[model samples]
Target: MTLTQHAAPPEPPAVAAESVPGPARRRPPRRGPGLLLRPVFLGVVALVMLVPLYVLVVNAFKSQQEILTDPFGLPDGGPTFQYLDRVFHNAQFDIMRGYAVTILFVVCVNVLSVVLAGPAAYVIARSTRRRYRALMVFFLAGTFIPSQVLVIPVVYVLKVLGLMGTVRGFVLFETVLTLPFSIFLYAGYIATIPRELDQAAAVDGAGRVRTFWQIVFPLMRPVVATMVILNTFSVWNDFVNPQIILGPGSGLYTVTTGVYAAVSQFSTDYTVVFPTLLLAIAPLLVFFVFMQRHIISGLTAGSTRG
Candidate 1:
């Protein structure tokens, strides 16, 4: 009978509850519903944000009659590009020139901003001097002031310099308008990086310029991408600045100002204007979508690290 010798009670499995050094507790299984809520919430939010966009897209392809008759509905006649044609072909607004000026203006502003701010931010971040605080305050204060307040002064200065309504003027003004914020962003982000990197670069033959270009600049990619997106959007869609600087009926109109050309005191061309607005925003939307991944990291970089 004993030949079926009690197999020694199976030694407790290595990670058995009783074998655990402390009171053993099991984690509740993550609930599927709770896990699913985030995507569901985001999807709902995305749909909500897209309602206006849906209206624009639907109305852009339709006629004035369709827009008035079924404002909330999709295009009855499919996408009609006549409005686009009219918007671009209108004699009052030089749409092609506007596009050219806009591209040039955006490029120059981004170039000047990155080139100037990169070094300035590096210096400000790495500086130990007490006066740097004042400098930082000066730059960041520009962000708080409404641009309208400076309109008269900006116009006067540009007028004196013979830069008014010129692409050069737009580039200079946009760069100045944006620099403070760009420097502020770059400075905050650069501070999080350790000095060890700079030192390592210095230990080699790398000087300040080389160190910054080779070592520091590469790490600033996320922040730079963020700046590029922001500066491009601001310069591209600028209405008030272009209006004030370029003056009435200026050939230097951008896509934004071109949209304004569609409006009059007595009536507005909703069909053409709406399509033009869509065209104006299309580049911004596409850029944001493509660069969306970099945005989160870039925005957070200043607060993270060290």
Candidate 2:
């Protein structure tokens, strides 16, 4: 009979409704002085770099009156193409012609330099002999010598050879000036490439010329592209060399010299000067835009290989 009060079936084991541990608290968004300062630093840097380009573009569109009145302001109305028109029509025609000559110079120099330097670089990289090493060091040391320092000597030599004032003369000078660096860069890159590739080619009956042209040359496209772009820009923009060697009214002015001549002659004539400047820069801009991918690729290739 038990005074067993029917214990109510122990309340169903207390169901725990909540998780044993509360939900993880998200970390407070990190805030530090660096985070605040970074954007400001970047903005300042961007502003500093952009100011000159902004001024150039704006001044190109402005009349002399506008430029003098408000050097830093936006155009009073819409931008005008008058300066551009004048430049295209008259101010820079000769300069544009010079640009064409520069293009020719660049192409020739790049092709010749690459052809000569490629083999030299390959040999220097693969050779273990002390004599070849000494030669490589000599070649590299030449790069430290300033071209300007040699100008007088070069002119004298060219004069002796009766090659002055000729395109061929300029080509020869540039080739010599540019070759050392090209060879150095190529050698560094070639050193990183496995010699086994060359050995394999030779084993398969590929001659040196054939192996280089078919195998090595293809692999070097990025470096070649970089060399072309660099040499092209240098040759195109070269003012002092062309100015001194080509002389005035030689009809052989490069764009840089042409623009300089325009500026000197016109002085404050913005209509002429702006357009000339614009035209002078236009080719470089176009080239950079078009070849940017290749340039970037070449840079990456050289960096990684070296």
Best candidate, lDDT-wise? 1
Per-residue accuracy of model 1 over 21-133 as CA lDDT, tens digit each: 87668999887987889899999999999988999888888888888888889877578788878767666666677777788888889999999999999999999998997
Give the top-scoring candidate (TM-score).
2
- TM-score, each model? 0.82, 0.83
Candidate 1: 10-residue stretch with minimal lDDT: 260-269
Query: Which lDDT value does model 2 have at 84?
Result: 77
Off by over 4 Å in 1: 1-48, 265-267
Which stretches in model 2 have alpha-carbon errors above 4 Å? 1-45, 91-93, 302-306
User: For residues 124-242, what per-residue lDDT tens digits would candidate 2 score against the true structure?
Assistant: 88889999889889999999998888888989898899888888888888888888888887877777787888999999999988887887878888888888888888788788887
Q: How big is the RMSD of model 2?
A: 4.5
